[model samples]
Target: MDLDAYVVAHAHEWARLEELVRAGRRTGPESDELVDRYQQVATHLSVIRTAAPDGEVVAYLSSLLNRARMAMLGARVLSWRAAGRFFTHQFPAALYRLRYWWLGCMAANIVVSAVLMWWFVDHPEVEQTLLSKQEVDDLVNNDFESYYSEHAASAFATRVWINNAWVAALCMALGITGVGVVWLLFQNVLNVAVVGSIMTRHDRADLFWGLILPHGLLELTAVFVAGGVGLKLFWSWIEPGGISRGNSLAIAGRTMVTVALGLVAVLFVSGIIEAFVTPSPLPTWARIAIGILAEIAFFAYVFVLGRQAVRAGHTGDISADLLEDRVATQD
Candidate 1:
């Protein structure tokens, strides 16, 4: 009850606790001892609160307790272990869990592009209606191919990365609207159809495929992934599956974050292929081969490692430690 006397009596114990905390890592006995010391210090603080409530002692013990809590919990943010697990487990698991959504988006886009391409090819004069003769000639003979080579390789690659990353980000961002994602995809496929039809009609089909395939495969897949993930965000609220709509939407939004981050890297790789491989002096087959390999690697990453991570109980959502507390809500 005498504050000064109490301090003198427990000063050695307090010093010992501080020593164990600053020791960095501990042996088995030391860990047990640390826990014991922590409990005693907490009790000491409690007694002070009730009996003396000394300001300086309370503050010191509070700060010590905060550090001790983090150390015991092993909380990490900017660590190699966290970053590595994010990519290998969390990212892939998210991709695998929602594989069908993106796969369907990819398939639907391909079919729409093919159908529109065929229609445009069948009606070659339709392009002539939109563009003047000179414009068509310039696009077929110069514009499409020259676009890739006009900028320096590194500059082009960076520009392409930023542009493609933006598109993927937009897809996910607009997913909440539901219709926004569909409209974006439609516009994307429509552009592809128009261009493919123009090239095929002008007897430049080979040129189109050579320039596009080297980057388009993986590039387009990333777009579909973003679009699909975005749609998942929308669907969560519409059908929350026994949970409150707010809770479901929050979970989906968090899960989509993993896709958003992973897609940035994916888009960067495709941009490099587009800027360098697409326009390089390498044989068309080799360039296309590189693109194919990248696309396969992405899918394999999703279906293989992602699948395993999901089965191992790794959700694409942020780790529990990183999540904020939520309030209950009605469905």
Candidate 2:
């Protein structure tokens, strides 16, 4: 069929589409197919305008193009509004699930902790090399037991809590970018490696409880969760299924605010303990128990309590039981 003639014939629909597009309510899936049809027709009209000389085809194509542009703009605006609402409503629930998400983080910490503990137990002299002189001196001579007893009396607790909270929030926020997450993980890995090397040299396997586990458990777990989120996004970029990479990022962005909130809470608590209790005279046995218990608590909440709460609160069919599953399928 002649392109000019076709566009001229569809002038009525084109005019209506223009009005619908301007209305903006005719967006989303309902209008998407219409938009696609309009585009295909417009493309044909453009070709006809270009090829056919001295014909009404140029005017016809112009009219179709204008209408299609309006419709597309309206659809985009409506889609964005809908996305905004979905995120606003879902963010709190996602944040609430961080306790469960921390299960992965806690497990990572345990693995790293065990490796460091084993290495430190086998080698004790590396402690001086791994840690700064100040750290070595404090660990070896500053009398942690005395420090602990006095820590509660000082403003240290409040100071530490605030500091740790910032760190946790920063880590989670950075997780939005793949490069940021890589930098974060590298810094943490190096720091832990150095500390692990030193602790092994000191023949102090229990140092983890005093210097590490108290707040470290929570602090480190938050790091892992942040890393996991970043890593997930990175992998999505690498293998974006059938969708465009930008689309995958949009989905990830949708879920990040909640993840960030959870990280902030975890860090706040870690900071409080690190500033006051960890350095003070708390019994090594007690610290170990607390650390171990906290790890256990996280897993229990994630696998048990989290599921129950989500099920009770969410009556709509969720399609899947796990977060990863839902995300994957949706993407």
Candidate 3:
């Protein structure tokens, strides 16, 4: 049978059997019947698991966990709203969790960019060899700020976001292919080099302020989050430690939801600023200040605020709702 049909046909019986097995129920006729049903369902699920690779299974499982986590988070946040809480308590912990992936992505990107910058600095003529006349003119004339302000708003930005997001998702999905992480790192590094070249050519040494410092603080953060999610699955196969790859992937997959959700938030905010704010007529000082403040807020959310959510002790009512929801879902 198809998966949904198989699940529907035996889900109740399987659940009953699980409950009975957990409660130390013995093999009476009903128990035997439930056992038979459980075996059939288990066999089917096992076949499906075997046919799928670890990444697909982990992705499927992660999706389920993500839904549950989001529901729980939403309900809690809603309750906090009712009680007049500002709901900033969860951001810092989330940021802390994102740190691993961001650092990894950033390190790889930075090294490549630095090397390229050194090469270009050593060979200025190479710029003309590579760049087109228009590009060379812009770089030589230091006109990127105006160019960025204009192009960042064009439909090209949307296309860029979609294309980048698609690449990230595919890289994340392709972790099953064993080379997904490497592929992702290569693309990330290349992008960094290209951007760095432009910044260096224009002598905008404070490139962070104009090119990246504005919305980049968020956009790059999202990219790092995406890379981290991919690394989770990649590491499962490459260096799972003592655990089996499947189990390691499962564990990492659980955390991927949090990272992906946070990435979504980052992308949404970044896209808006990139489209309207980053490209517009803002003073360099103001842009730098905003960028710095935004980064600080981001760190505070992921590291400090997120950790406090579990212990904020708002009320037991929210906890009761959580338990009830879990029980209902399980039932």
Candidate 4:
């Protein structure tokens, strides 16, 4: 319990551990010695925290152990094999597990958009109330169709990707509150319905579907996925089942972060479709077919590879070994 005496007694081992960590590369014997000293120092740090409660000594040991850990494990941080597992296993598994949430979100949003679009078309007065005649005329005659082709394809694609990724990230980031995700998705639904009804009313239905379907399918699906995952995150702590709420929230938060990383690539693909394929000179059917294929491929990724990964015990979390930094104290 005497912090000064304890420091003097164990300072030699801490010094040895530091020496091993600083020794460029390790021989087998030195590596063994480093491992032993690392464990001893960790024990000392814990005892100091619980028994002596010395801030300065604890801070020093914590930093030393952190460096020791990186020295031991840093070489394996970047590996193609790890990346491969992440995409094929971790990402897909998370998708599979969260499929119900996202799938339901996708379905509900589609229905809401369709129904709202129909309502808007049925009640043309609502459009007039919202937009003046000049605005409506401009949107229908030009803006609706020209929007996709207005910008250079690559720049447009990047912009769309960044925008969509931001929305998805917002969903995951604010998922704990539950309201932000719903508000975001609702805003998206409102925008789509308003625009689609305008096109339909102005007798530009073909042009609208032709331009939108090619990219909208996949892009909207990605949005729905994010919304669903966000809602699921909110539910994790609320209905934690048998687990402690903190543990449930922690697990869901980790999973949300993992899924967010995967969604960047998803949003990028959708953005590419939106920018290039949507405005391309290809037949509308052909462009829409590409979008359908992409959407199908995403679903397949979730249901097929994702399911297999889940069966094999992947939960989209970072590997167990890396979570060693988490320490539990007495409850």
Candidate 5:
């Protein structure tokens, strides 16, 4: 194959292809001509690569082919439609699929918290070891309730949002380690249980529930969801099913990312309730009812909207075009 002679023959056609691509606007005739020239140059480049393997001309044709391909395909532009699809379809589907994991986490944490609270109520010495007498008194009589109203509502909400978001983010980020999620949940549950125990011992259990339930319900649920997604990621490698371990991890990782993003919105709502509603002058029943409504709404969002999206074949992974091409394999 005379590579130089081949180039000479097709050089003018390649130049014309470049000219059409660079012209920005194209008539129907020019667009048709561009497609034809692109195909011709692609074939020319293929032959050159097969015959000569490495050369400046092959590189030039390769670059030209890439630009023409992009021109034909058009650039991917971010739009409101893509954003809507993500939240309506992708995000909810991910949450619904991992619902069991997070729900289990929630149930287990509740039981553990209750058990610890019971133990603390039964044994006064355990509370002493955790906090000194003055500290315990302050927490029960003064600090526990006042903590909520100390800061302005807006600043407190922002603080709660950042803190809870960080914890949830850590759960997903450290979920690959398996034990990290468990440890985080354990630490959180223990703190809540201890506080409740102290309040109960002081005969302020009503106060405890009144202050915590308004925000704790949704706030803790968001944390459980994050932990659940993290644990799912960990298990993907342990039991990859029919897929390759790497592929399983990739799928779980993408889903975890989706859950992480979704949780930000979830935690924000909880933060608002915690800062504004929990410490507000509203009746305790009203505050708790609002929290319950928020919790119910979130679960409904998952089981209702999420189920439909999942049924429609969304799996929370990135769109197919965004995924890398992989060779097909048969198990």
Candidate 6:
């Protein structure tokens, strides 16, 4: 394994490969030659690593291989068409597939929040322990309502969007730990329940709903979706079924990315509602109606468009060429 000798021997093939990569366009014969040389140089690189392990030769070969690989794969070009398809097909399909997970999460949180709210309303002592008399009075009378309109609509919307997006991202990013998602969801539901309970006790329940229902419906749904996806990612390893745990996790992780991106748009819409519609002079009924409509529209997108995309074999995964090839396993 004379490194110098080997380099001299395969240097021509490496140069040919580099040339083809840099040429931008090649004839059929040149393309065939490029592939042939790439294979030879890759083999030579492996031998060099095994025998001599010369850093200079290794670095050169690595760079050459990278260029050759790119030439073979072709450059990826982002376009409006691809972006449109992603939102319409990939994101929605991912949401629809995970509908049950998020829906269950939503239902559970609602029940917990409602129970807490009821408990707080029935037991004034508990509420008093959580917040003092003056704090409760301020929240019920002015603080809760004024919080929405305190800032300008645009700034408020941006702030809300960033905050909510960060929460959703955390759910997916920390989902693998299993506990992170649950902890986040619990914290959020607790906050909501505490607030709802205080408002209800003070006879300001209408004001609470009037302000929150408009944006909270969609905002909470998006959060639940993230939590569900995170939990699902955690479950992929726990119950990988027949597939290898690595493969299951890889698939789930990819799908989780899709959900995270989709939630951004969902949260953005909710932010808009919270900033503009919630604090606007519109009637409470109208504001709540708008929120309900947005929620319905989201569900429709998932059930209708998402279902269609999934049925057509879209799994919210990147194209096959982008993914590593996995060995087929029998059930």
lDDT of each: 0.88, 0.56, 0.57, 0.87, 0.87, 0.86
What's the number of clashes in each of the models? 0, 10, 14, 0, 0, 0
Cα lDDT tens digits, model 1, 63-125, are 776566566546344467877888999999999999999999999999999999999889877
Best-performing candidate as measured by lDDT: 1
CA shift of 210, model 1, Å: 0.7
Candidate 5 per-residue lDDT over residues 300-320, each given as its tens digit? 999999999999999888776
lDDT (tens digit, per residue) of candidate 3 on 1-331: 2556645665575566545444433445744554454444444445545543256543543344344334445444556463343334333343454466657776776677679767776777776677887876665465655655556375646755675566656656665564676677677766556556656656666753465677777676667667666766677667889989876776556455445544555666666666776766778778767767777777666556655653564211222222212211110
Point out where model 5 deviates above 4 Å: 1-78, 326-331
Q: Put the candidates in TM-score order, highest first.
A: 4, 6, 5, 1, 3, 2
Quote each prediction's TM-score.
0.77, 0.53, 0.60, 0.84, 0.78, 0.80
Indicate whether candidate 2 or candidate 6 has the larger lDDT: 6
lDDT of 6: 0.86
Model 1, runs deviating above 4 Å: 1-77, 325-331
Error of 5 at 87 (Å): 1.7
For residue 52, give model 4's deviation from the true position in Å: 8.0
Q: Which 10-residue window of candidate 4 scores lowest in summed lDDT?
A: 322-331
What lDDT tens digits, residue by residue, belong to model 4 across residues 288-320? 899999999998998999999999999987766
**Model 2 worst lDDT run, 10 consecutive residues:** 322-331
Cα error, candidate 4, residue 133 (Å): 1.1
Q: Which segments of candidate 6 are over 4 A away from where they belong?
A: 1-77, 325-331
Of models 4 and 5, which has the larger TM-score? 4
